[model samples]
Target: MTTDGVEAVFLETHNWGKAAKFFQALGFDLEFSTDHNSGQLRNGDGPYVFIAEIPEDREPGVQIVLKVTDADAFRPDPAVEVVTPFEDTHFGTREMTVRDPDGRLWSLQAPAKK
Candidate 1:
């Protein structure tokens, strides 16, 4: 299926404080901070950024979130490997995970069904 476009960037960091500060320096304003050492940031009308803390032993990485206007209508191509089906998120959206041919994971986000 066709996706709207890139919606946000998900980042994993060992040091939440430093990572937040780094993105803030790049002109991203913190939209909201969760008690769980993570937060969402935005620069303007563009896609936002989400940073979450991971264990020190884990390597930091970034993943892109693709926007889907209608999760129920999404029918990905047969070649796409859907690692996880769309599920409601604590943060309010419905999200799905997919692995690329190269084995990289990506996230697809759509508004929760009413």
Candidate 2:
């Protein structure tokens, strides 16, 4: 039930290309780019940043990723609603999503299950 710290932050951008370039100009190195509508940037240390392009109708915001010991075992608080249940990601992690009371999205992720 305890969180260590933020592992990443996902930012919804209207243009992934522009956003990536912007972050890169600010000293964030491109870790990788994916065809899945998103890319990752990092300062070569902890807390990587991710940018994802979404529909114009959707609001752009930041999603905080929390490192958890067991993403599957972690449940959302009564005040929050589960968006995506814990599932294995193609990038090799177990992740779950929830919408906080303020409507901000949060993700809980754990190392890939062995």
CA lDDT, every model vs. true structure: 0.94, 0.85
- How does residue 69 of candidate 2 score in lDDT? 85
Best by TM-score: 1
The alpha-carbon lDDT assigned to residue 83 of candidate 1 equals 98
lDDT of 2 at 67: 88
Instruction: Supply candidate 1's per-residue lDDT for 102.
Output: 100
- lDDT (tens digit, per residue) of candidate 2 on 1-114: 766688899899888999999999999999899997799999877789989999899989987899888765665567668898889998899888888778877888888887
TM-score of 2: 0.74
After superposing candidate 1 on the true structure, give the runs of residues whose Cα lies further than 4 Å from its correct spot: none
Q: Please, what is the TM-score per model?
A: 0.90, 0.74
Residue pairs in candidate 1 whose N, alpha carbon or C atoms collide under 3 angstroms? none
RMSD of candidates 1 onward, in order: 1.3, 3.0
For model 1, what is the C-alpha lDDT against the true structure? 0.94
